[model samples]
Target: MESSTRTGFAKRRRSLQGPFLSEDNIDVQSDVYIWNSLLSGYAKSSMFNEALDVFRRLLNCPICVADSYTYPNVIKACGALGIEFHGRMIHGVVVKSGYVCDVVVASSLVGMYAKFNLFGDSRILALSLQNDVVLCKSLINVYFACKDHCSARLVSENNIDVQSDVYIWNSLLSGYAKSSMFNEALEVFRRLLNCPFCVADSYTYPNVIKACGALGREFHGRVIHSVVVKSEHVCDVVVASSLVGMYAKFNLLGDSVQVFDEMPERDVACWNAVMSCFYQSGEAEKALELFDRRF
Candidate 1:
């Protein structure tokens, strides 16, 4: 029975891995644990719709009643999707099922309400729960989203006792980039660079490079390129792609081509980045030649 449950969970997890999963792939015989595992895995992986699909399946299954473990994953998925109405619906279910007291479920609810800018609701829910780093980070993110930068900074500062990690810095960097605060993004990247213990990885390079691209700062971009080389993450496909894009944006087609050429394993995305560079630089013929070669 335990083995079957794990198999069912794996099957559901694999089904939800793609951009579009076929309905036929779902295992109708999956138990509550399997369904809950699917929901949890999918939500954590940012497969929000897939997580919701698992939740709906659980809701319909007579034998698969969602327990406390199930609510947190579904609630987080709802939050990530920014569907406040459905989030509230899930909240009602949580209250009715008496899972509201579960720390995981409560934290997810706080995050969900904060995601929708319903700070009042989030604060009320949060008050009943013990403060944790995850909840604190959620508030920081929500405040940042609401353009309360000062509050965001204050929250992060107040939580200084909680050691910061590269992930938090990356989050701040990406947030700045999204807000078109490229300079600030670079500043955050600089702060991250100065940290002795924290190391920038494949994920870090792309966002910083993206900020450099947006500013058209070739000097900074070159510096980042050197950093990527030093970090030995230059071969990472995402980093390579971002570097190609950064060079392309700066109208340095030659540099973009050089980066693309050096990539040992070129995916369709990397190929497209180089082709796009050529196309955007008024080299349609070259772009076509590359596309033909790719095919």
Candidate 2:
């Protein structure tokens, strides 16, 4: 049986190489796996039309019942093509197949619906995930993308315990920052600091610094600066860039310059940050000189 399966796969590969690998020649019972493999191949190659064609063909195949793997790949194809109707159809299949409760499938549905701006369906699907941290984060991100800060906060507050992982805290803080709830984001940042063994990543500090910049909360930014120094994460380009940007936003051009100078490594963004500070402070000539040197 294994040898026959190998032979079938080899034949399928050869058939695939031909110009006319049509549905007529494929033995439905023996070729179901091959068809699914081809569908995945098409999806991975970004051949959305071909992937959908294979998916549609699979729907009619007697041997190919829509399963967990099949639905996720087709949903991904729908997402890639921005085909909301197709996604909804796949959602229906998910429900019919009793796969809606599958965490992986449910998460894919949430991501697909979110990408297509189907927030209602996305929220419903997201809430159904039992213990999926990534799905919860994706749902928070979707709400954040939709500019529904209240809903995002509610999702985070309800689904995420105080003992949630750093990724969850970062996601919640990022959602707050994106919504311009700088004070709330700062509060969360403080709470994160209090968590035992909780250390901020490049993502955590940048968003928090951005919140400080947006709110003109330079004192808060300074305190964060102290933390960054103590944590030895100050060398991260993103953190340094955010610090420069935060100082610049508060009209502290001198402080911005000082931070820029102290950065161990500099990127184009860091150069831009300093140049922006100079320009915003009415030192256009210095800004131009810096830009010229950097470029």
Candidate 3:
């Protein structure tokens, strides 16, 4: 079986060459794989319109049936092009073909709907999944994007047993922060701290700190400071810069300046954070001083 698979792969690779080798030349048995490869190549190249054109051709082909790989690339193309009408039509295809039960297809559908701000449909599709964590996470993010925090919270609560992956947690936190639900975001952060295995990475802190800054919750920001310090991730430039920005926003100039001073290495964003803080605080002289020093 492995040797046969290798031979098939080698044949596919060879078929990738030459201009006049039409799609018609592909064996009927290999049509799904060939169409998928072509669709994927077109989607990756950002030729979404061309990918849709090929998808339409595939749908019209009498012998071909849309498979799992076919829908994801085409749905992604629809999302990229903001072609919600086409996306709905693809959903119809999925339903009629009984591919709606496929997890990957369902996830792609949820993402496509979400990209167009169609949260109602996205949520319905998400709930239909028997055990789809990825789709649920996508729905959470879409709900957050639509500013429907209640819906996002509901999804998270219901999916608590779904073994929240890092991406899912990040999406929930980011959604709460983006929606200005700083307290809820902080509560989630606190819960994360209790999970011994749930160590925060660089991506986690920045969004949480941004939420603190937006709400001017200086105490929360300070707690995050202590967390960063203890995690030994303070040396990370991204985390340090985010802390500086958060403190600066909350008018904690002393803490902001201290974080900046302690940063062993600084990037353009780090300098910009302090400069923006100085500008916002009406200390034009200090801002200018820092800008001059950096330049």
Candidate 4:
């Protein structure tokens, strides 16, 4: 009954908001809810700075009290901007407001801490919640961000459902690539190919191709090229660039040249890949020829 009343009140308040504000006669309590709504909307729309702006305004208004919904959005903005001090301030507010136990706000705090590479804090916050899949996923992402692949793998392996999660696979692939663990990245891709749990997408193909290039694994590169073609992502700029780079890195100039020529539209990256291929393969003249034609 109380929930229904609040919802109806919110609906009526939303309708009255513009008129009330225009008249500068909105009640203080309505102003708090309106600010919370604005802050949440801004954060959800990825307008982090604007969310922070509204947050600051809310802070200056003594009549407005920060609620559970308000803290998460504010913390999200702080996280997105990597503002640790502001996040900490919001955390303190959350604790005093007794909102630290709220799952949504807690998850946001965990995610924010993880974003800033505060792995220990993230871990502690994540563990406070039980049977929360969202929190577990955030914890997995935190480990990945920390480059603790062992811990990440452990978490992923322990979570039975995450095995079929494409985002988890993408995170692991990205983590491996970022850490220069090219061989491990390829291995993960190989596993991904065999698993019926998930299928490769544009994001997956490019990273795996990059790993193949780094390892000079021409055969693996060929296999991935076929997969890319079968996946019908051949024209994707990022995948195409990775293919060009992979072929070039293996000194397979002909295949690299063919891929470059086949691109329907060439970006600067494609051109750079073709030129770098020749340059890296000790074909300076060919590299210069391509460079000259690029003008």
Candidate 5:
């Protein structure tokens, strides 16, 4: 009964909000509290579209600005709705509005990515806030915790630590790889090889390997494998899994199997990768056999 009353109140408030402000001689542009309440009501009632509409109204209202109080439940709505394009746009606004550093707003953004696994959207959002190191670090940590190392590889971002050559070079490598500019990716990798300050870590090999695979340059991939082996960075699960896929992409079944077999531990992704490699290579029995071993 009480829940129904709250819903009724929310509905009536939506209808009468403008008139109530006008009648009360309140400046709609200055009364952010009213707008926030409306947003909260719509979001709490699961009226996500309505809440976003209210946000649009708030944005359209002259001289009005959203405060720290405005974003949590609304962002929750975005996550509930899969953090769509609108959410990404709003995040850009949040950064510009300088509310991104607000603990509540930060939490909501983190929750949107962390709870929903919208790493792609989250990564985009994180990259947009190039000026806020704290929020970027927070979001980046979440991506790393989720083992989404690719997202950590950074896009075409320049603001992140120019002092760290590895960070900058990796960003170039990853940005090129992500954009499917395989030649550019390899160029960056090759350049990094000569840079005394930039040593490619486990973080660096996956995208470089992916580019080699994309270009179908198995020889280049093998050369990188040699570098990884010499650098003693071949043991990481991510890099090892990438090697498995890269060798498989080259149709080097023996090489792919050798890489897979050498892993000290196998995650589900690594297991699925090798199975798919086997299945694609017309080794159905072997795929099933591997599945049984996994079980």
Candidate 6:
């Protein structure tokens, strides 16, 4: 343990090293609030190895009980460290802990499986949680992650936004676009546009535009481009890069060049996109010119 962790955590580390406790004998023995706080802090701070050490100690403690809150961050650390074996073991713990469907806990489990590239396991875990019931907000991200567009949409019905949480829609859309399910991504974007309160943001458009480009939806891409010009995120470089790539994908290199040339400023990605567009269009001279010229 580091000195910084001692701020709010004094007994946590010591208590975590008690004796080998079995989950099968879960008669609940100790208050693990401080322990959880400690682990959560370590995992969130990108201290993967430290988080695992704490988790191991927590399991060895005869008095402390692991709950739904305990697994997510530790499992996230497993994913971050690419320890698929440890992650899967913790996943079994999650299942046995009866938090498989827990709204607060399920997303991390699903995301961890995705990180493991066990997409099938991710889908199985998600479907088992639903059990033919309507999908909850947390399960939507991994559904699209496994390329199950129908279930993702089924869960993403406008009614699911009872709290009017834009995060639900954003996660749903991002999952689809990120997994290369372009049509589904567009459908989510359409629904997002229809929702009066669930406004899109800078984080939203690049995935949507990437989806459009992948599907060769030139008309839809152009429509989104016009909307980008009017929206507050127009000046966003990532959105700008996506636009440049979208036009290039549409075989409208002229439009791509125009979008690139008009940028008030450019990042390496934006410059690369424009340069690649020129290079792909057989304009090696322009690409070289851009490469040699740096602001």
Question: What lDDT is reached at residue 67 by model 5?
Answer: 85
lDDT of 6 by residue, 74-171 (tens): 98899899899998888888888887767767778777877777777776666566532323566785566555666566554536343256666677
lDDT of 3 by residue, 172-214 (tens): 7888877778888887777677755456777788888888888
The regions of model 5 sitting more than 4 angstroms off are 1-171
Model 3 bad stretches (over 4 Å): 1-57, 60-62, 72-104, 111-121, 128-136, 146-148, 158-164, 195-197
Predictions in order: lDDT: 0.75, 0.76, 0.77, 0.77, 0.74, 0.75
Candidates 1 and 6, the one with greater TM-score: 6
TM-score on alpha carbons, each prediction: 0.59, 0.69, 0.68, 0.62, 0.54, 0.62
Clashing residue pairs in candidate 3 are none
Q: Which residue pairs in model 4 clash with each other?
A: none
Q: Which pairs clash in the backbone of model 1?
A: none
Best-fitting candidate, measured by lDDT?
Answer: 3
Kindly state the number of residue pairs that clash in model 4.
Answer: 0
List ranges where model 4 is wrong by over 4 Å.
1-69, 72-108, 111-141, 158-161, 292-295
Looking at model 2, the pairs that clash are none
Encode model 2's per-residue lDDT on 1-295: one tens digit a residue. Answer: 6566555645664467343345455554345566667777666666677778877767876655666777777888898899989888888988988988765677677778777877776766665662566666666676676675655555555444423667877998988877778898998898789777466777789999999899887788899999998888899998999899899899898899899989888988889888998998999999998788876
Q: Using TM-score, rank the candidates from best to worst.
A: 2, 3, 6, 4, 1, 5
**Which regions of candidate 2 are displaced past 4 Å?**
1-23, 28-57, 67-69, 72-92, 95-104, 111-124, 148-151, 158-163, 176-184, 194-197, 288-295
Per-residue lDDT of 172 in model 6? 75
Question: How many pairs collide in each candidate, listed in order?
Answer: 0, 0, 0, 0, 0, 0
Worst 10 residues of 6 by lDDT: 20-29
**Model 5: per-residue lDDT, tens digit, 1-295?**
7589667966696465567444444476578888888888778777787788778777876667888888876787887788667677777787898888775687578657755677766676666654554555454444545556566546324553431447556655666677777897897787778765547888889999999989999899999999988987788898889989888888788888998999998778788888888988999999999999998
Mark the 10 consecutive residues where model 5 has the least summed lDDT: 155-164
Please name the candidate that would achieve the greatest TM-score relative to the true structure: 2
Query: lDDT tens digits, residues 81-102, model 4?
Result: 9999999988887888888877
The per-prediction CA RMSD against the true structure, in angstroms, equals 10.4, 7.6, 8.2, 9.8, 9.5, 8.1
